[model samples]
Target: MTPKLVAGIEPPYYTAVFTSVRPDAPEGYAETSVRMQEIVREVPGFLGYESARTPGGIGITVAYFRDLEALDKWRLDTEHQAAKRYGREHWYDSYSVHIGKVERSYGFERE
Candidate 1:
């Protein structure tokens, strides 16, 4: 697990966490992941994303650059916008988005 109180990172980053209801989504999981990956690549501040499915729903967290404008652009991205509509029309039952800026962060690393 990542630290709750992180500190000391050179460049700032954006932390976005998204959680959504699966509601009979097993068949489309692969398709959804592929679409998301494609969209992320198109976004200006494209970074990385992690996702997992549980009995109740799917959880996705994407870490990207420190640009609110870029983030907003992604929100309104053509493909993504269409996907959002499709999600509301079909894919997801419900979802929530949480966005925050990472001012300073630190974590103990041991491998």
Candidate 2:
């Protein structure tokens, strides 16, 4: 079974969406990714995160934060900086990051 990569977050929050193409050789990608996940949880204002990937090597990760300040801090984290460097050097072929404020959101779930 596949996991759900969508987080349940409240409004008046910030979202960081990262879209990227997989690297040809992901040597330490998995380990680094797990480490980053753990690190983010410890950061203040971190709400949640979700991720998904396609068979074609394209992927997206969405992380929620209480505000832009928290998001900016996460972006400058030392460990995350290392990961970004690694990604540019060996992991990602291409990528883009977009941060936005979610003013209103609505959804439906049926049992």
Candidate 3:
């Protein structure tokens, strides 16, 4: 696929979306969650991740990256596979991942 090129930055960036539903998880669940996130850090195109837990049954995560190929590598990674298995059996009740290209982003944080 020909990557979409933006004027300000590079092309073919990666975006990962992970959603889940964990109704009644025990305490320390979030603590363990941190460990899971660390695994993603080792993935090739793991740019960044954002997450939230809602009232009813909603868990969402988005991970950004510099290239889709890197994202694919992450998806097929061995440790990632194990984490997925663990999520299926224990960590998460349900989850999903949506990936996309980041065409543009702006920052103006005070330095």
Top candidate by TM-score? 2
- List the candidate 2 regions with Cα displacement exceeding 4 Å: 1-8
lDDT tens digits by residue: candidate 1, 46-89: 56555566776665655564578768877877877787787778
lDDT of 3 at 36: 65
- lDDT of candidates 1 onward, in order: 0.69, 0.87, 0.69
lDDT of 3 by residue, 14-88 (tens): 678888887656555666667767876786656666666788779887777778777877788786677678667
**TM-score, predicted candidate 3 vs. hidden true structure:** 0.67
Write down the worst ten-residue block by lDDT for model 1: 2-11
Residue 34 accuracy (lDDT) in model 2: 88
Query: Model 2 — TM-score against the truth?
Result: 0.90
Model 2 per-residue lDDT tens digits across residues 1-111: 555544456789999999999854378888888899999998899998888788889999999999988998899999999889978998888999999999987765554
Q: Rank the candidates by lDDT, best first.
A: 2, 3, 1
| Cα error, candidate 1, residue 2 (Å) | 15
By TM-score: ranked, best first: 2, 1, 3
In candidate 3, list every pair of residues with a backbone clash. Answer: none
Better of 2 and 3 by lDDT: 2
Candidate 3's error at 49, in angstroms? 1.2
